[model samples]
Target: MRYSTYFLGCRVNQAEIEFFEDKLLKLGFEPSKDGKADIIIFNTCAVTNKAEKESYRLIRKIFATNPSSKIFITGCIVPLNKSFINQVKERIVQDNEVLKKNVDNIYIIPSTQKEKVIEIIEKEIIDKPHFDSLEISPKFIQRSKYYIKVQDGCNHFCTFCIIPYTRGRSRSKPVEQVVNEIKDICKNIGNNSDFGAEITLTGICLGEYGLDINTSLAKLLKAIIPYIPENARVRLSSMDLITLDEELIEVMASSPKICKFLHLSLQSGSNRILKLMKRNYTIEQYLDIIDKLYKTIPDLGISTDIIVGFPTETEEDFNLTLEAAKKAKFHRIHIFPFSFRPYTFAYQKMRHIKIDHEKVKEFEKKLMILSLEQSKNFITERQGKEYDILVEEGGYGYTHNFIRIKTNVDKVNCFVKVKIDGIEEEKGNFAVAKGLVTLPV
Candidate 1:
C-alpha cells in the first residue's frame, strides 16, 4: 500500500513524522508523493488556536482533494484533552464533519498511542511484516542533518502552554539506544561525506532528558560523542534555563562536535509576567545563564523565544521585556503573540486582566521589528569571518554557529568554507557570503 505523512509544530513533531515515514517504508509500504494515497497520515498540532484551525482546514482540504484516500489524524490535536477534542468536534459537527460520514476510512489516534499507527495501518489497509521483524533505518531528507528524538513529553507545565497535557510526563530514550541509533545511521549512510554528518537531538524538554533514568543530558552527550564519526556534529534542541547546568555548558564548550548555538525559551522578560506564566527562571537568572554561556563558548549564537502581550502585561512590563531583549543581544528572537489556548492556566487568567486587542497587536508588531533588527545586527557582526557551512539544496546552508548563508557553490550536502561579505539584499534575515572553497570532512 502507498502512504503519505505530514506534520505541523516544532522539530519534535518533524522528528516523529520522519520516524513514522521510515518505519512505514521498512514495512513494505510505498510512498505516495503526488496525489491521493491509500493512506494519508497527518501528525497534527494544536499548540495555538491558529494551529488547531490550520489542522482542521488541512484535513478538510485533503479530503476534498482526495475523497477516496483513508485519513489518519494523530499528534497533539487528538485525544490529548477530551474537552479540547470535543470543542473541535463540535465545530466539525456544525460544518462538514467529513470523518463522521466515512468513519471506517478515518482514524483518530492519540499522541500517547502513536506507536499503534502501524498496527492500525496493518488492520485497516494491509498486513505485511510482523512487528518484531522490522529493522529500522535513517532516511534524513532535509539536507544531511539527521534529527534524533532523545526524549518524549514534558513534566513542566508552563501556564501558557498546553504541551505537557498533550504530551504527558517526560520520558527519555536509553543512552545506549540513542548511541546505537546515531551509529546505525552513520554506518548505513557509509563514509560517503554526502550524509550522516549532522545530528540534531530533539525532544519536548531536551534538558530534562535522562532524569527519570538517573542520567543527565550531559552524560548522554558525553557517551554519544565518542561513537559519532569525526566529521559528524550533534546539536541540542531548545532547553529551559533552569535545566541548563554548568556540567552541560562545560561539555558543549569542550566538544567540537557540538554546535556553538543555543536556543532558550525565555517566554517573557518581565519577571512578574514570567512568574504568572509559571516559568521557573527570573530575568536575572536568565541573563546570568546567557552571560555564562557567552563566557564559555566563543562566538555563540544565542537565540530565544519571546511571548508578547500576555494577560496582565502592562506597558512597563513590555518596556522591561524590550530592555531585556536589548541586554540579551539575542542572535535570533522568535516573537509570538500570546495565544489563548483552552484549558490552559493563562486562558482562564486572561479573563481577569486581558490586554486590549489593538495594544496586543501593537506589541506584536514592535517585538517583531526588534527581532528583525537583532537578527540583522547579529549577521552583520559575523561579516568578514570565515566559517564552515553544510551546503544544502538551492545553495543555501547554515554555519556551525547557526548563521544562515547563501553561496554560489553548486554542490549539496558538502562542507564549504565561506567568508561573509554582507547581508543578503531583500532576503533580510541571513548573510550573503562568498564561497571560499570546499572543505575536507
Candidate 2:
C-alpha cells in the first residue's frame, strides 16, 4: 500500500504525522511522494472555528482529487465536535451525492488513545510488503530548520482558547526518550547528503515539559542539550512566565547551541483578563521573568501572543495591553482578535461585552502597529551590530536572536557573521543586515 499524509496547524500535528509515517513504513506501506496513494490521511487542526472549517475544506478537496483512495480524518477535528462531522458529511453529500453512497469505508481515527492512532496507520498498511522498522523522524528534505514536538497538549484552559478540549491534558515524553530521539535525528542528519539542520523543541506548553512526573523543564533541557550535535542548534517553542526559573534561564543564556529566541505566550496584559482566562501569572510576574531573561541573555529575541477583544475586554484593558507591549518591546507579536469557540466557558455567557466586527479589526490593526514600532526600536539598537546567523537559505537566514536577514549567496543553515543594517522603511525589519557577521575571537 502507498500512503501520504497532510498536517495542518501546530508542531504537534506535524510530529504525529511523522510517527504515522514510521508506523506505515514498519507495516510495509511505501510512502507516496505525490498524492497518488492507496490512502491519504488528513491530520487536522481545530484550534478555532476557522481552523475547523479549513480542515473540512481540505478533506473535501483531497477526497475529490482521489475519489477511489481510502480517506482517513483525524486530529483535533473529530473529537471536539460531532456537529462538525455531520456538516462535513453534508458538504460531501451535496457536492457528490451519488459518490457518497459508494464511499462507505470512511474512518475517523480515534484520539483518546495513542495506540488507536498507531493501529489505524498499521491497518492501512496491512498486507503490504514488510520493511525494516524505521525510526520515527521527519525528512530533512527542506532543512530550513525543524520543530520537534517534545511534549503534547495543555492543562491550562484559557477561556478564549479551544486547545485544551481539542488536545487533552499535558503529557511529557520521558527525558531519555527525548534525548535519544534528538541524538538519532542528529546522526541521521550527518549521514544525509542533502542538508544540515537543527531542531526546535515545541509543545502545547513547553515550560510544562516535565510537570506530569514532577520533572522540571530545565531538567529535561539538561538531558537533551548534550545530545544535540555542536553543529546543529536547538530552539524553544513557547514557555510560560510562571515557569521561568533561574536554572532554566541560566541554561538558555549559557548554551551557545540554543537559539536566543524565546516565545512567551502572554495572552493578555490586564490582570482582570488574565484572571478570566485562568492564566497562572500576574502582569507583574510576567514582566519580572522577561527582565531576568533580558539581563542574562545578550541580544535575546522575545516574542509573544496577544489575544485582544476577549469577552469582557474593556477599552482600558486594551490600553494596558498596548502599554505592556511597549514596555516589553517584543520582536514579534502574534496579535489575534478573540474568536469564541463553542463548548468553552466563555461561549455560554451573554452578559459580557460583545466585540463588533469593525471594532475588533480596528483593535487588531492598532496592535500590529504597536508591535512594529517595538520591532523598529529593536533593529535600531542592533544597528551596525554583528551576529552569528544560522543560514537557512542560499543567502538568507535569521540571527541567533531571531532577527531575519537575507543575502544572495549560498548561506542556508550555516552560521555566518553579518552586520545589522538599518531596517528598511518597507517590509518592516525582517529584511535588515548587510551580510553575514564574523564572530570576534
Candidate 3:
C-alpha cells in the first residue's frame, strides 16, 4: 500500500505523524504514486474553530479526491468532533456499490486508540498479512532532525484551552522505553556525522514527563546526555510555565548536547486577562523567569505564544502584552487571535464579549513587528561569533540558540562551525545571518 500524511497543529502532532509514517513504511507501504495513494492518514487538530473546520474540510476533500484510498483520521479532532464524524458516516450510508464495498474505508481513530491503528489495519485490511514477516526498515525522508514523543496529554486544564479535554490526562512513556527508543534510533542512523543532526523531545506537556514513572524530565535529559553524540543536539518542543523549574535550566546549562532555545508558552501578558484565562503563572512570575532564564542559559533564544484578542482584553491588556514581549526579548512570537472554541471556559463565560476584528489585526501586526525587532537584536548580539550548526538539505541550519543562518556550506546533515559574517534583512524573508564556514589550517 502507498500512503500520504497530513497534520495541522503543534509539534506533538508532527511527531505523531512521523511515528505513523515510520510504522506504515515498515508495514510494506510506499509513498503515494500512480495518481492515488492506497491510504491517507491525516492527523487532525482542533485547537481553534478555524482549524477544526479545516480539518473536516480536508477530510472531505481527501475522501472525494482519493476514492480508492482508505482514509484514517486521528488526533485531537477525533474525540471532540462527533458531528463531523457522523456527517462522514451519513455519506457512507448512501446507495453506492463502490462505497458499500468499502464501507469500512474511513477509520476515525481517537487519540486514546491511536496505538491500535496499525493493529486494526493489520487484522482488518485484507491481503496484507505478511507485512511483519518482511525485512523492512523505515527510511526517514527528512535529511536532519528526528522528533521523539516522550509524553502525551496534559493535566493543567488552562481555562482557554480545549487540549485537556481532547488529549485527556497527562501520561508518559517509561524512562527505559524512551531510552531504548533513542538508542535504537541512534543505532539505525549511525554516527555517520552525515545525519542525526537533532532530535526533539515532543509532548503536549513536556515538563510533566516521567512524573507517573517516578522520574522527571531533568533526569531523563541527564540519562540521555551520555548517549547523544557531541555534535547532535536535543531540544524540548515546548513547556508550560507552571511545571518549568530551575532543575530543567540546570540540565540545559550543563549540557552541550541540549539546545539553548526554549519555547515557553505564555498565553497572555496582562494579569487581568491571564486571570480570566485561568493561567497558573502570573506576569510577575513570567518576567522573573525570563530575567533568570537569560542569565542562566547563555545566548538562549526564547520564543512564546501570545493571544491578541481575548474577549475581556482591553487596550491596556494589549499594551501590556507588547511591553512584556519587549521585556522578554522573544526571538519569535506566535500571535494567535483569540479563537472561540467549544468546551473552553473562555468560550462559555465570555462568548458574548468580542474584541474588535480590526484591533486584532492591528495587534498581530504590532506583535510581529516587535518580534522582528527583538530578533534583530538577538542576531546582532551573535554576529561575528562562531557556532556549530547542523546543515539541513536547504544549506541552512540553526545555531545552539536557534539562530537561522544561511551558508555557502552544502554538506547536508553534518555539523559545521561558521562565523556570522553578515546579517541579511529582506522585506519578505525572515532575517537570516550569513554564515561563512571556518576550516582549520
Candidate 3 per-residue lDDT over residues 91-169, each given as its tens digit: 4336656655665688887776676567666777744553442122344564368888889898887777888877888
Worst 10 residues of 1 by lDDT: 426-435
lDDT of 2: 0.72
List the candidate 2 regions with Cα displacement exceeding 4 Å. Answer: 25-34, 80-95, 110-115, 128-144, 191-195, 350-353, 424-434, 437-441
Model 2, residue 417: displacement in angstroms? 2.5
Which one is best on lDDT?
3
TM-score for candidate 1, residues paired by index: 0.93
TM-score against truth, every candidate: 0.93, 0.88, 0.91
Q: Number of clashing residue pairs in every model?
A: 0, 9, 0
Clashing pairs in 2: 391-412, 391-413, 392-413, 394-411, 417-436, 417-437, 417-438, 418-436, 418-437
Task: List the global CA lDDT of all models.
Answer: 0.78, 0.72, 0.79
Task: Write one digit per residue (lDDT tens) for candidate 1, span 1-441.
Answer: 788888888888888887888877766778887957888889889887788889888877776666677777887777576556655445543455555565456667778777778777766567654473223565634337777888888888888887877888999988888887878777754666655357899998999999999999999999988877755678888888888888899999998889999899888879999999889889999998888888989888888888887888989999898888888888677777777876678777675765687888788778777777877788787778888787888887788778788888787877777888777643432234444444534
